[model samples]
Target chain A: MTDFWLAAALCLLLTMALGLVRVMRGPSGGDRILGVQLLGTAGIAVLLLLGAAFDMPALADVALIFALLAAVSVAALTRRRLTREDS
Target chain B: MEMTLQLWSMLCVGAGLFFFAVGTLGLLRLPDLFSRLHALTKADNLGLGLVILGLLPWAGDGFQVLKLTLIWLLVLLGGATGAHLIAKRALRADGEEMLE
Candidate 1:
């Protein structure tokens, strides 16, 4: 069980790395935001896997909060961007 | 019976991992932000859904099952909302570009 969890975590890390490459090299703010979105989802996955791997339930609690926060941040950013564009 | 459950879990997790891989590949190779978002939101959501479902039987308690399910739901909400926001902005930009 731990082995499978660990493998899932490792694979998520790979996804995060790929997301990072996009974040660093992406041509515009859109790509950066997209990258952040990728990171958020992947981060949650890693946390869940780690929770399973270590038998720690708390990790999932954190993931729940993280998901809400990630959405809020993107909403805030999008609001600001639209406002700035209109003005 | 134990082996069967384990085997089932393993397949689910493996499939989940493959979806993540596909999501990342689409993220990297897609031509634009909207298309990438399209790939990611669909793939990752399905991926995580599989993972959580796989972990359900192994989970130690009822609370853990609830927590995992909540986490998956929250992520789906976040991904959908975020992708919508990004796509709206991208479309706006596309419109502006067309105007110019």
Candidate 2:
């Protein structure tokens, strides 16, 4: 079970790395932000899997934090864009 | 019974990971922004939800299970809002009016 959890974590990390390719080459800022969004979700999964493998529930708190931050980051982008358009 | 639970957890987690991979593939290979955004929501909603559901069996306490469910709920709310904001911004930037 430990090995299974670890392997799942590794696979999620690879998914994150692949998401970066989209981030790097995305044609628009929105696309890049989308890539970032993918990273955030995948990162949370990784943290959870690692927490299970290592017997650390604290990591779930960390994952929670990541969730909040991810939401805020995109909102910030939208807010900035709104301000730019307004001014 | 314990073995059965473990197997169920493994199956769900594996399926979740596969969805995650599929979403990434769509993000990389899809032809347009809206299409890619479509892919992303799949990962956010289904992928993450399944993972948390799978981990419920391994949760150490009742509180832990509750916390995990809350985390998934938070992500669900956030992901939906973020996706909308992104699509709206992208649409405005393209000078396209929102579809009714």
Candidate 3:
């Protein structure tokens, strides 16, 4: 709940928003994937910041789960894309 | 002691934010998929690490710290693996012409 954490979180949110531009304007699918990854990473950081600021330790766990799933999603997408290419 | 912790936390968090900003810039400005992947992995990993470090002092316990570290490690591992796969796929679909 401190000013410092709040400000940092806001900055991270800004980066996530900027990343969306890349997602929307991508020259390729990989680039869009990268944008989503950026957003996911930023979102994790924001969750951690909020967890700290609000003294809710449980949010950290949510962030952990989010991070794990985000990575898996990327891997799954890449695999699917690769397999699609074979056919 | 409290003031020092606050200052240190601010410095760490600010640095993390800066790295994220740089990574986003790289994503925006980088000319190709490989280079963009390079930017995303390096900057975002370091950025997330620094942010976690900044928040370490306030962590509820040793368990939380461990959890945070695990999350970071997994993200990096996954990101790297995914990047490799994407590169392989991109190269295959586009042929060698995509890189140039």
**Which candidate leads in lDDT?**
2
Tens digits of per-residue lDDT for model 2, B1-100: 9999999999999999999999999999999989999988767668989988889999999999999999999999999999999888777665532221
Clashing pairs in 1: none
Residue A74 lDDT in candidate 2: 80
Best by TM-score: 2
Query: What is the lDDT for A85 in model 2?
Result: 61
Q: Write the per-residue lDDT of candidate 1 for residues A1-87, one digit (tens) a residue.
A: 798789879988988898788888886677777777778777887888898899887888888877887788777766533346677
lDDT of 1 by residue, B1-100 (tens): 9999989988988898889889889889999877888898889888988988888888889988998888898888888888888788767774442112
Kindly report which residue stretches of model 2 are placed more than 4 angstroms away from their true locations once superposed.
Answer: A80-87, B94-100
Task: Sort by lDDT, best first.
Answer: 2, 3, 1
In candidate 3, which residue pairs clash?
A1-A53
Which portions of model 3 show Cα errors greater than 4 Å?
A: A80-87, B94-100
Q: Assess each prediction's global lDDT (C-alpha) against the native.
A: 0.82, 0.89, 0.84
Interface RMSD of each: 3.8, 4.5, 3.7
Judged by DockQ cut-offs, is candidate 1 incorrect, acceptable, medium or high? Answer: medium
Query: Would you list the clashing residue pairs of candidate 2?
Result: none
Cα lDDT of model 2 by residue, A1-87, tens digit: 899999999999999999999898888787888987898899999999999999999999999999999999988776533345677
